[model samples]
Target: MSSLREKLKTLEELQQIDLDSNEVRAELETLPAKRAEIDQRVAEARRAYDEEKSRVEGNERERRQLESLLAMERDKVKKWEGRLGEIRTPREYAALSREIDIAKKTNDGQSEQIKALVASAGELQKTLEGKADALAEREEANEAELKGLEERQAAAQQRLAELDARRAEAVKRVDPGLLSKYENIKRRRAGVAVAQVIGMTCDGCHRHIPPQLAITLQRANSIETCPNCHRIIYAAEAVNPPAPPPA
Candidate 1:
C-alpha cells in the first residue's frame, strides 16, 4: 500500500508538469500566426493610404490640365478682339466677331470644367488626409501589439525551458513500468494519465466508479485503473483531506 501511494504521488506530480508544458507549447505554436495577423493589418492600412494619395494626385493633374486649356482659349479670344478694330469690311468684321464668340464659349466651358476639377481635388484631399490619419493610428496600434506579443512569447519560452527541467527531474522519480503506462495512457487520453476518485466519481471520465473499485482506491492498497477510462485512479481523500472532525 505504501509503495502504491508513493507511486501515485510521483505520477500525479509528473502529470501536472506535463500539463503545464503542453499548455505553454500550444501557446508558443500560435504566436507566429498571431504576429502574422498583425502584419497583415498594418499592410492593409498602408495600402489604403497609398490608394487615397494616388486618387488625390489624379484629381490635381486633371485640374491642372483644365486650367491650361482655359488659358489657351482666353488667349485666342483676346487676339480676335484686338483684330476687330483693324477689320475694314463688314464681312471681315462679322467673321472676327463670330471667331471671338466661339473662343469665348470654349473658354467658358473650360472654366467650368476647371472649377469642377478643383472641387473634386479638394474633396479627394480631405479624404486622403483622413486616410493618412487612420493609417498612422493603425500603425501605432500594430507596433504596440507586436511588442507585447513578442515579450509574452519570450517569457513563455523561458517558462517552457524551466518546465522541461522540472519534467526531466520528475521522470527520474517514477518507476519505469509505471512511467511507461502513464505515457501510453497520456497518449490516448489527451495528456491525462491519472484520475482522482471522489465519492465514487471518476474525475477523468466523469463517470460513476463501481462501488467495489472505489473502495479499493480508497484503501490505496495497490495501483488501480478506472475500468471506464483505463486511467490510473487514486482516491482524493487519500491524497489530501480536511482537518479531523471534532469530538
Candidate 2:
C-alpha cells in the first residue's frame, strides 16, 4: 500500500507519461522522413527505368533506319549488275564497272551499319527488360511495407487514446504539489519518480536500505526518499516480494 501523497505522485507521473506517449504524434513525426526516403528510392528506380526505355527506343529507331538503307543499297547493287551484262564499249564498260563498284561499297557499308545497329538494339532491349522487372518488384515491396506500417500506426493511435483516457482520470485525483514533484523527478529519472520499498530494499535502485532507515520508512506518514536513488519510497508488499511459495 502506498501513502496518499505517494500514490498521487505516482498517478501524476503516469499521466505525464501517457501525455508524452502520443502515438499519433510519434507516427506523424516519422511519416515525412519515411516518405522522403521511399520517394527518393522510387524516383531513382523510375529514372533508371525511363533511361533504359529511351535507350531501347533510340536503338530500335536507328536499327529500322539502317535496315531501310541496306535494302535500298541491295536494290541498287542488283540493278547495277544487270546493267553490267549489257555493256559493249571499253569506256562504257569501265564507267559501268566503276558505278557497280561504288554500289558494292555502299552496300557493304550499309550492311555493316545494320549489323551494328541490330546488336545494339538486342543489348538495349535486354537491359531495359531487366530494369523494368526490377522496378516493378521494388514498387510492389514498398507498397506492401507501407500498408503494414500504416496498420501499425492506426493500432498504436487507438491504444494511445485508451491510455490517455485512463491517465486523465488518474490525474484528477492527484495533489498539485505531489504532481509537480513527480514530474520533476520523472524528467531526470526516465519517467520513474516513486518506487515501492520492499522490506529493506530500495526497488528503484535494488540497493538494501539501512536497518534503521527501513524501520523508519515503514512507520513514516511523510514521503521518504531512497538514500541510494533519491526516489520517493512506499512500503508496498508487491515491491518487497513475500517469501517464495512453500515447497
Candidate 3:
C-alpha cells in the first residue's frame, strides 16, 4: 500500500488539475465578450462608411436638380430673345430684353456652380474610395483576430476537458473521507483545497504556520490543515525531495 505521503501528493496533483480547469473555465466564460467587442468595432466602421456614402449621394441629387433648373432657365432666355424683333412697341422690346438678360445671368451663375460641384465631386469620390479601403482593411484584420480568438477558445475547451477527465480519475485515488473533506474545503476556499508547505509558510495564503505543525507536515505520516487559512497543507520534501548532487 502507498504511504500517506503518496496519497497527499496525488491529491495535490488533482488540485493542480482543478486549478488549470478553473483558468480555462474563466477564459471560456469571457470568450463571447471578446468576440462581441470585435463585432462592435466592425459595426461602427460600417456605419461611418454608410454615412459618408449617403452624404455623397445627397450632393449628387442636389447637382442633378440644379442642372434641371438651369436647363429651364436657358430655354426661357432663348425664347425671349427670339421674340425681341417681333415686339410691338419700344417698351415691350425693352421689357423682353430685360427678361432675357436676367435669364442669361441666372444661367451663367448655375453653370459656374455646376462646374465647382463637378470639380469637388472628384475629391469627394477620392475620399469615399479611401474610406472604403480602410473599412475593408479593418474587416480583414478584425476577422483574423476573431479567428485567432476562436482557435484559442477551442483549444482552452479541449484542455479543460482533458483536465476534468484527469481530475475525475485522480479523485478516485484518495480516501473517500479525505476526498469529501477536500471538496468541502475547495468550495469554501475559492477552489483551492490543498496548499503546499514551503519552509514554514502556507503557500496558499502566504501565512506562517506553527513551527511544530511545519515539522509534523515534513514527517509525511499524516495530512494537516493550515491553522490560519484552513487549507490542507503538505510538505513537498516528503514527496518531491531535492536531487542529490553528483560526486
Candidate 4:
C-alpha cells in the first residue's frame, strides 16, 4: 500500500512539473508574434519617412523648374527692352512694346508660382523633418522594447531548461509501464493523464465515475483509471489522507 501510494504521489509531482513546462512552452510560442508586431510598426514608420522624403524631393524639383522658366522669361523681357531705342517706326515700336508687355505679364505669373512653390517647400520640408523625427523616435523606442522582449525570451528559455531537467528526474521515479500509459493517455487527452476524483466525479473529463470504482479509488491500494476519461484517477483523501484529522 505504501509503495503504491508513493508511486501515485510521484506521478502527481511529475504531472505538476509537466504542467509548469507546458505553461513555459506556451509563453515561448507567443514570442514570434510579438516580434512580428514590432517589426510591422518599424516598417510602417520607415514607409512614412520615405513618403515624406519623396514629397519634399518632388517639390524641390518643381521649384527648380519654375525658377528656370522664370529666369528665361526675364531674359526675353530684357532683350525686348533693349530693342526699344532702335525702333525706327511707330508701327514697329508698338508691336515690340506689345511683345514686351506680354512677356512681363508671363514673368509676373511665373514669379508668383515660384513664390508659392518656395512657401510650400518650407512647409513640406518641415513635414519631412517631422516624419524623420517620428521615425527615429519610434525606432529607438521599439528597439529597446524588442531588446526587453529578447531578454524575456532568454529567461523563459532558461526556465524551461530547468523545468525539463526536473521533469527528467521526475520521470525516473515513475514505473515505466505506468509512465508509458500516462504518456499515451496524455496524447489523447490534451496532455492531462491524471485527475483527482472530486465528489465521485472525474476532474479530468468532468464525468461521473462508477460508485464502486470511486470507492476503490478512495482505498488507493493500486493505481486506477477513470473509465470515462481514461486518466489515472485518485481520490484526494486517499493519497494525501486529509492531514490525519488535524493531528
Candidate 5:
C-alpha cells in the first residue's frame, strides 16, 4: 500500500497546480470584457469628434445661405432706389419708399445673422481641432493598452496550459483512491480538498485537532482529516517551512 503521507504530499502538489490554473482561467475570462470596455471608450471618442465636425459643417452651410439672401436683399434695395426718381403720385412715392426701407431692414438682419454664424463657426472649428487632437491621443493610448492586455492574456493562457500538464503528471503520482476522494471533496468544498495542520490547528477551519490526531499527522505516516472541515490534513512542516537562518 502507498504511504498515506506520500499520497497526501502528491495531492498537495496537485492542489497547488489547480489553484494556479484557476487563477489564470479567471483572468482569461475577465479579459474579454476589459477589451470591450476599452473599445467602447474609443468608439465614444470617435463619435464625439464626428458630432463636432458635423456641427461645424452645418454652420458653414447656413452661413453661405445667409450670404446669398443678403446679396438678394441688397440688389432689391438698389433697384428700388433707382426707381424712386420715376415715381409721380405721392402714393406711388410712399410705396417705393416702403419697399426700399423693407429691403434695407432685411439686408441688415441677414448681415447680423451671417456675422453670428461666422463667429459660431469659428468657435466650432477650434473645438473640433481640440477634439481631434484629444481623440488621436486617446486612440494611441488605447491601442497600447490593448496590445499589452492581449500579450498578458496570451501569457496567462500559456501558463494555464503548463499548469494543466503539471497537474496531470502530479495526479499520476497520487493513489487512485485518494485522488478520487480528493476530487469528490474538492467539488463539495470550493476546490480545497486538502488542508494543512499548523501546530494543533486545522488551517482549513482554524479548528483545533485532537491531540492524538495531531501526533499522527506529525508522524507523517498516516492520512487524516480535519474533524471540523473534513479536508485531508497534513503537517505544515512536511509541505513547506521557513528556511533556517544561516548558522
Candidate 6:
C-alpha cells in the first residue's frame, strides 16, 4: 500500500496525461480542417480563372463573326459601285442608283454591328484582366495562410511529442495495476480517468459520495473508484483536506 500523498501524486500525474492526450488529439484533428479551407480558396481562384478565360474567348468569337459580316457588306457595296456606269437607259441608271443607296444602308448597319461587337470584346477583356488579378491576389494570400497553418501544425505536433515523453516518465512512477485501472476508466469516459474527492463529493459527477465510501477514500492509499461515475478517485491536498501534521 502507498501513502495517501503518493497516491494523490499518481492521480495528479494521470490527470496530466489525460490532459496532454486530449490536447494532442485536438491539434491533430484541426489540421485537416485547416488544410481543407486553404484548398477551397485555391479551388475558387482556379474557377475564377477558368470563367474569365471562357468569357474572353466567347467575346473574341463574336467579334470575329461581326467582322466577317462587315467585310461581306463592303464587298457588296464595291460591286454595286462598279456596275453604276454600265446601265443602258436612264430608268436603269436610276434603278442602279437606288440599289447603291440600299447597299450603303446595309453597309452602315454592318459597321454598327462591328462597332458593338468590338466594344463588347473590350469589356470582356477588362473583366478578364480584373478577374485574373483577383485570382493572383487570392492565390498569394492563401499560400501565406497555408504556410502559417502548417507551421502551427508542426509546433503542435512537437509539443505533443514532448508531452508524450513526459507522460511515459510519469506513468513509470505509478503501480501497474493502478495505471491499468486508470486507462480502462479513461477509455470509457471521455479523456477523464481520475476524480478528486472533495468534501464527500465525487467531482466526476458532482454527486455526494456515500458516507462509507468517503470514509474509505479518506484513508485509502491504493487505487479507488467513484461509485457514481466509475472514475478513479483520489484525495487531493488542494481540492481535499489532509490529516493534520504531527507536532
Q: For model 4, how does the per-residue alpha-carbon lDDT over 75-163 read when each residue is reduced to its tens digit?
A: 88898899899899999999999999988888888888888988988998998899899899989989998999999999999999998
Error of 4 at 92 (Å): 4.7
Ranking by TM-score: 5, 4, 3, 1, 6, 2
- Prediction 4 TM-score vs. true: 0.90
Model 3 scores a C-alpha lDDT of: 0.88
Q: Which of the two candidates, 2 or 5, achieves a greater TM-score against the reference? A: 5
Instruction: Note each model's CA RMSD in angstroms.
Output: 2.7, 5.0, 2.1, 2.1, 2.5, 3.5
- Tell me which residue pairs clash in candidate 4: none
lDDT of 3 by residue, 1-247 (tens): 2479779988889899989999999999998999999888888888878877887887798789999999888888888888887889999999888888888888899899989888878888888887888789889989998999989988998998899889889988889999999999999999999999899989999999999998898788887999998999998887677888998
- lDDT string for model 6 (82-193, tens) is 8877867999888888988987887788678778877887887888888889888988998899899889888888888888888888888877877888788888988788
Better of 3 and 6 by TM-score: 3
Q: Estimate the TM-score of every prediction.
A: 0.87, 0.67, 0.90, 0.90, 0.91, 0.82
- Please give the distance, in angstroms, between residue 75's alpha carbon in candidate 5 and its true position after superposition: 2.3
Off by over 4 Å in 2: 1-28, 35-41, 64-107, 196-212, 216-220, 235-247
Each model's lDDT:
0.88, 0.74, 0.88, 0.89, 0.87, 0.80
Q: Per the 3 Å backbone cut-off, how many clashing residue pairs does candidate 4 have?
A: 0
Clashes of each: 0, 1, 0, 0, 0, 0
Model 5 / residue 4 / CA error / Å:
2.6
Runs of candidate 3 exceeding 4 Å displacement: 243-247
lDDT of 6 at 207: 88
In model 4, which regions exceed 4 Å deviation? Answer: 87-95, 244-247
**For this target, which candidate reaches the highest lDDT against the unseen true structure?**
4
Worst 10 residues of 1 by lDDT: 235-244
Q: Which ten residues in a row have the lowest lDDT in candidate 5?
A: 1-10
